[model samples]
Target: MTRRSITFRLLRALLVLLALTVTALLTASFWQQRERVSTAELVERAKAHDVRIVRDSWGVPHIFGAKDSDVAFGIGYAHAEDDYATIQDVTLAIRGRLAMSKGSEAAPGDYVVSLLNIWPSVEQRYLRDLPEDVRAVMEAYADGVNLYGAEHPDQVAPSALPFTGQDVAAGFLFKMPFFYGLDKTLKQVFEGKAELVKTPTGSNGVAVAPVRSSDGATRLLVNSHQPYTGAVAWYEAVLESDEGWHVAGGFFPGSPFMLHGHNEHLGWANTVNAPDLVDVYQLTINPDNPDQYRLDGQWRDLEQSTAWLWVKLWGPLLLPVPQTVYRSEHGPVLRTEQGDFAIRYAGMDEIRGGLQVYRLNKARNLQEWQAAMALQAVPALNYIYADERGNIGYVYNGMFPDRQAGSDWRGTLPGDRSELIWTGYLPPERTPQLWNPPSGLVFNANATPFHASEPQDDLQPADFAPSMGMQTNMTNRAQRLQETYGADRSISRDEFRTYKYDLTYSERSALVATVQQMLALDAQDDAVLQAAQAQLQQWDQRSDRPNRIGALAVLAAMPVVRASEQQLPAVDLRESLLKAAANLQQHFGRLDPEWGEVNRIMRGKEDLAIDGSYDTLRSVWGEEQPDGRLKAVAGDTYILFVEWDKQGHLSSDSIHQFGSATLDPASPHYADQLPLFVEKKTKPVWFTEAQLAGHIEREYRPGEVTLGK
Candidate 1:
């Protein structure tokens, strides 16, 4: 071969070698970077602190540590072991990165996150609004979650790694409003559609003072409902630290601190409260300049930014999707066919409710709890609290905007008026709250705060401002509570427990109303209809399993009754009844099938018959199967009964619809609680370490969490 050709060939070979070298170096650097930021390293650091988690026979974690932050770390680690996917999903959603993993379906959620400016606000307020101690707890929690992802690398999404304290903070800030129906409002804005038939989200929180309890013991029932498993499903844990953090109750996926449960001294429960905390301002925009909006008689520039969403195109391939977000003098702005509207919400700038919850958790008494609540970091909820001191209080808690009183606050306001933009909140005093009522009790089943107590001690509705948007709607559970307790001045412990699990639909309930409507219909000409009406009339308003009439009653009344309660009644109750009767007969080959045969509770490998209807005290709302039978989806998940004896000794009993290991089928806890839940039973909370000793399934530190053989 010629020397010139050989030289040329040699040079080309040299060039190819150089390119390969560079590529190898780049790949090595990427791997090194990932290794440098190893989340498992964070877990090792957490283990340096003294934290021990003891999983009881039921798979519930009883976490003990030297410090509160250590306990939080342990709880995070334990929760990840049970439901890592959900926890990761929650963090992904909060970071506006869910679209990157979940694709097109989750893009809307990412858009809303960016439109509402959640992460931006978190970034701005994380170090500013959140207290240092709260930040430490959240950081430890993030570290624990990251460690789990690091160890179980195959289980995590491609982009999710090294979860940060900011993720924990943002998760709390973003998901907190969902319990209060913020998602429903967002759906109205984005989809331009409202739910036709609305049923109240169920949570029955009742507190009875010592004076009202026959044995002079204070009792509180904490029953909050969510789907069987999801972002908001409850996971029970008992967290304790030598530094005085001892709490036992249920918490959501990403929350480091307990959501609703009790410390040794006192405990509280939360029910969703929807006051007018959000306002949409219709802005006058200049067509020529899209960035300009009118405010206070002058055209002003909108604060604009582009949020780049990394949408998943294929596996590991992300495509950039950019959306322009705008902010006006009022708040976050969105443009739609309706108009340019700005949403000014209470939690738009706040990211410190987690700290408030922590403070409430460590509270020792009613006064201490009240002091923590006065922070008002949480925008809205109904807080039902009880203490060892035999004091019970109910607060229709919300951040009441100090908006101008003369205008209709419930509807859209003009953005041009600067006064319409509320800059402050109503102080704690102005918010509707009752200390210890003369009736010695208070309850909220998503009902009006004005009727929280007995008639004599109930707050006068006329006294509060219309701008607060306090609901006047009553539910079957609320009416049942009132009639049960109001009938007698003092209630025994058994009665308190019995009433909580009562399966009777109240007389004032829409179920009764809808049934009455159906019975009143003229069916003289239709023999089939007469037979159905007669069966319905004999229902006895009971929802027990073997009751033949209840199956038909629940099927016929649930849809129409829920609608009637929400002011969206069915077109015809008689039509619904006829369809229900036909469905029942087709499925069971009889009009009067056993209630259990129709209504079932299905989980994992077990599908068992369940008793209860939508609005009954032992509420169970189920979805229909292909064969026309109903399978319970929601209504009751976690139920807790807290009682303090006359001598101030506290004992609590709790149960979950499913076991502690959320989605793990191999885990023994997956369905352990189902039988107890169906039979209306509760296991002891087992708060003290000594109480948990004999039941220990496994004990370990954060990285070392293991399932028992």
Candidate 2:
């Protein structure tokens, strides 16, 4: 989940200002030097019985197997065939061996892995904590990845061999909290390097129940705004087995279970939610002993460890970079400029993320789904759910620590007091939740949980403690959703689809506010500012291809929006406007350029002008290019629109910024969905066994399918 249901505007800006922060190039020499694995041996050891993979026309894998473990194995094999390089990169990052091949860029991530003590957490808890069935799925998936790596030595980092089940589990433990902005939090408090302009993280999720639908149907919008490429980006797949494991939706790289999507009976969408789950405690150090800290009126020895990173020095040679890490009772300690601050964030010692997701995949109804959510291993994400039973719901889910009532946990805490520490979380019922609201709708645009549904049915923020830091502000998208979706009663399925693609910025939006401020400026004294202000004032705030005002206003506010999540370089309204006007005149020979001309989507050899702006329901966040244009980099990555008809027949359609093969530019699937995405259209999702029969583009076993097939 990347969005909160409700939050305050001030905290939102500070949250943005606070933070910001992949891969080995495989070569022929690595292949030549390695002992290649035999395909026959892989076939013998994989144990993928009754596995039959049918790749749909869109090149999405629909894997079928006799057992649940077999389907997991097939998903591993199929996903590896599509994106083996990314699998290695994900696994490597988890194992803290990424620096061995990627060098300095990956070293910090490797070091964070050490600082978080993630591996030891996995080591201590993985085998013992995970249920045997879940462990089987993880182990089988890892084997599939290992088999792929064994077969294709050419495209892997040398240190990435021997892929294990822990790697798969670690990937979940590593990525879960980051999705909730843990990395951003780490950079703000620890790294001390504030990013000026960063791609923001947010998502859109809404569920419509039969009670409010015109045709008595249910709909769920699975739109997650993410970088078009990366570890957190979505990859679509359909996994099913005879053993009752059936799910289709999106998964990250190296995932065996769908992170968000639907099975036959139910489906859920995730938006990132930020509750005050992380606690920063200032440790009281011993006067004489540097390695000891005062806690509970007693000086305690800090646990010390060293992580050795094999940093790439040259070809086939890695330099060992040893980093010392310390831990106190407060958790992982960071020696900041001011003091040693320890972090006790949710999922710090988590290994059950995989299990939580697996249960969600296998859940048949809202009860099962809620039961699975009770695991509370995912830590945080805003969930919008819809089922065939005409039920629609929202859950502002988090592993909220049951901290003591006296202290201000929202701010820094006293590490010396054990009473300030929390040992458990509120039960599932205690988290903000809604079921079948009177309005029959639930939505979150990274806003507060208080406004998640119809006002009457919305969760009462007052019921929760102030220490939770639950947001109380509205995003441009959330405000717009209120104006549009909330205003609409008895929504049709077609209307639901159209509403999710709304591209208008709310009047309350920061971009619009910036423009308003520029308009209020005494621009009459400056010719350029006057001209720019006049143009922006004429804007209708629709980021469409032919809109002239959109180009100038979007560009004028682009700098600020890009850096919204971090400390911004004082962006003067008049200065920003004048610069934008100048860039427009210089780059395209006119200030009134079409929105698409300035905002574009660029892939390898495929560049096209795209529409949409940041924080819009139909969001598109662009990176400023050298030539004065903004290249679409993130926002609105994978979108899935699902509907259950009057008779309970399920149908789904989706679009991706890229294709199923996440990293392969040569594949036909790559860039295939761009036109659909840009056109505000969706491709049919073949969910049933009937849909899979003839729609397949290619079908073969993992080892049998050639690269780029």
Candidate 3:
């Protein structure tokens, strides 16, 4: 054949080959799509477990089963029925895939998760690190969530599918770090700055022994200030199994066990402690090779990983956003405009937090509880424990780092020096703890752990090193707690409850000091300013209902306190004060209005003034709306007070800012607890099987219960 004729014939053959290849690609794509797990299959798997969930009048589920796994499965299904959206979000967040489910708005969160090496840590440690029983329970819980998503296809995201045991473990690995302020450290490094500032967010916990109570019963207050709604909001449940799994208290959306609450034998509470668990190190990059960083004066290549985040923009469309994350011998690497920094955070390589918590829930005595705490997997929190045996204890627990004995480790450290890097944590026993103090009372309002108990019974700060980064500042709540409970040698059950619900700040509180200073300001021709001063002068220092002076003080101080760490501008403070006065006048037609009238807890069609303020005994704080009203956001969500008699009998009561059903507005439980919460009342929390039976509204296993009144 001629050369031209051969070329034309070859081109024709190539076209045919291309057409066949396209057809094959299309066929494969279709097959892959069809192979994806369907909602029906997932639902069936979820229902395979024999777990029963009983709901009470308040919509709190009491899960029962023959095995621990069964109880976890039921708990997951019940929680999903109430808040599948949040559960989905939390799971996605843990997997570092939130951007895929929530869109670009979630990209930053995904980046942080990847930068923290969340999944790698879980993958490397999950199977071996998790106890056998705990793994079973977590797997069962994952199955239940997957089943719920399967049964309700419309509720599940497209790419999201049947979760596995690993997903459950990831949840703990991803969330626990943030509990101890690791997120704040990452944010600081990501912003290309280094400065340690005290945080305003905090929680309160207090435990009184029988000696301190007139009723001869030990009391433990579980008051954790968290966001009013969303993943961290409180959901009350009682998990029971003939196999010895029994608990009642608050848990987050996807948690398998009660995070803080009481069992038949004892009860406990947790307050966020800001002991420094994270350290940032400035790496010294080799001049000749940019990828190499010096550690211990030796240059080493940094381990790098590329993260692909599915940023959902709108509808089914998504963009794959890529981020370069690095890791080194220290920990996760953070890239910023200033340079690269490595973070060494507590529990970065630990995967036993859930196991430890599970053990704590099942502990029958103080010894067992102490053993659970010895796991040292939990990074930071002040735990207050009380038992029916009239035992009360407080522990400033954390996986504190054993840094170089004599080094300035509090601020940024030189990454080049491996000596400054820590690979393990101090044993739990070495951490500060006080058991059965002579004072008969212990408390921590997110303050320094050294002052957790009465003066003579408190822990000695000198015992711990400065490298531990223990907090030194006393919060207003801590001061108020000392002023009210510290002076009293003994307290009555009634007095204990009343003290926990105290809504007044001490006259000498920092907030009070600031208010007094503002009131002392010299008055100019600004009528609004003069009116505000007059209102402040008449204040009673109480955040109670119908107290008009609180509005003026809170409004004036909001802007000043909300300002950045930089010093507040004098002109801005004056402007804010005048504006606040105008707002008060415009809203109430006077410069003074009841504190309750200005602040409120609003949900659905219900809106009412709430009696509380930040740092008050009954603390509540939030953002203001355009209509000149404060909308509750955080400060008071789930509260539990457990009292155990000398006879080892357990009884408790709890209140949630909002009711148990987090999603359905039509459910009777949607806002049933709001009135009690606003009124500072609590309903009895029943743990006994008989008590649960008496309050049962419905009982069934997952995929069996019908959703309706």
Candidate 4:
């Protein structure tokens, strides 16, 4: 052939190859985006669900339905309307498909889903273990989400269609472990060694019986500290059904059940409680075979599977990355450069979490609630309960593994010994719990269960097994509760509300101790240091917005508190103080700006000064900014106050950091409640139809034009 003709043929072949590759990608994308169910079919499914969603003036959904499943459907649709993006993300994360849209940064979470065998367990037991009623609710919820996606195709991403009941079930399975810091353990293992950091994040739950109340009313504080926005952030809702599934409380993005709030007769609050529920086992790898491990004098092959993560390279293109997932007899195994470690965490292969939450939501009184608690499906959380009957209780809830008592459960154990693996959890009765204490008060501030109530009414350390690994740490919020609420003989309604929004740090708080230490520091001839110390000394240990000296003291103490929380070595407080002073002077031209001027809560164009600091009872944890301001990010996202008067009449008030439009900035409800939240005020919950009659902004059924408002 002629040289020119040969070159032309080679160029033509290359062009043809490129076209073929492009066609293949487009074809794959089309298949991934294909309609799982038509919008018409989804609407038909909605018709089967007799549910009505009523949006109150604050845009909180009050769902009325014929059955519990119908209520669940309404919850899914209403929550999706406000925060579908987060719900979609939760679904993707549970399905091990997050990397398909979020790119490489989310690959680890996707891989963890496979490595943990989350889907396999869900697929297996979602049908068998979960009862028909629970399964119906989950499936109906998924249907509602699917219906919304079908109607709003523009907002739907590829592979985001056809959310299933199993997805909802697996969400609890995957996300629950992270509540106790399993994700931190995985990160440490992946880095090289398992040097886990235990940072007990904030939340406060307090319940007071009528006996302790001056007005003869039972009170419950459902204050859960979470990020201002994300998968785990709180969304407020009120659900009612003919099947007795009435509840008014907070829910996570993808959850159908009210995580914490009040039902008609009783209500409870959840705070993150970390006991050592996760165990790491160092496996002995066989020399002859890399995939085999030594277990109980036998060479056992590690069950292996490949997790194919479809990472988004760009638009219409996905790169399939194959990662080998390993599992040992202990549980999910992670082979790292340090060693192959197997993790057996609480609620592993336990898929009945939704069932337990459903039962708890339907519980009419304390006895029924305790019966639901006995399920033990929920792995971790501190539950503070109060009801109409003047009963109050606290449970340091955990599915603590019944491990051999002699072993150091906190450290890595031998994977070779099958006997070391725990097959069951302790019964609910063995859990550290206090019911109707003589003090008429029960509370948890991410503190030890032993000191949950008055010293006399508290659970003793001797009562709980050391093998249970219950946390013994205390928090400043807990200290303040003891000083204020515990010290009070008869708390009035106003006092109860005032104490919840308490901005004063306890005299025993770490912030006070740190301030005292800072005041004692030798200025060392530095005028700036002397001035900063003087300002800190003026701190009244209050994080109120009007406090001028609090800006300097809390700013300086943040580094120490943060370091301690993250299990890092103590930061140099002197250096922190100096740096804080310099930043304050540089940004505000003074070292003592008002606390409000330094701390803010901003949403959209609205920026407002907020109260509360690092460990205060008000609890506003903020993120530092370049402008020397602390932007409130977490700690006190959702707050609920529930009360039952002597006549057994129920009432509630709640506040969210932002409004009902969780991801929609354009909506009027987006920041409508921000002012109230920043000002430490709450709107009435309007739990009953009679209360909601004059308050509703709009009402409609699912698959209607009322969405995306």
Steric clashes per prediction: 0, 23, 0, 0
Q: In angstroms, how far off is 448's CA in candidate 1?
A: 0.5
- For model 2, the superposed segments whose C-alpha errors exceed 4 Å read 1-43, 561-570, 704-709
Candidate 4 pairs with clashing backbones: none
- Candidate 3, residues 383-467, lDDT tens digits: the string is 9999989999989888899887877777888888877888778877689889999889999898888888788888898898787
Over 394-428, each residue of candidate 2 has an lDDT whose tens digit, in order, gives 88899888878878887788899998878888777
lDDT of 2 at 55: 89
Backbone clash total, candidate 3: 0
Local distance difference test, candidate 1: 0.83
Q: What are the lDDT figures for the candidates, one per model?
A: 0.83, 0.82, 0.81, 0.87
- 320-340: candidate 4 lDDT, tens digit per residue: 778999998898898888889
Give lDDT: candidate 4, residue 441.
Answer: 94
- What lDDT is reached at residue 123 by model 4? 82
Best lDDT goes to which candidate?
4
**Residue 256 in model 4: lDDT:** 93
Better-scoring candidate (lDDT), 2 or 3: 2
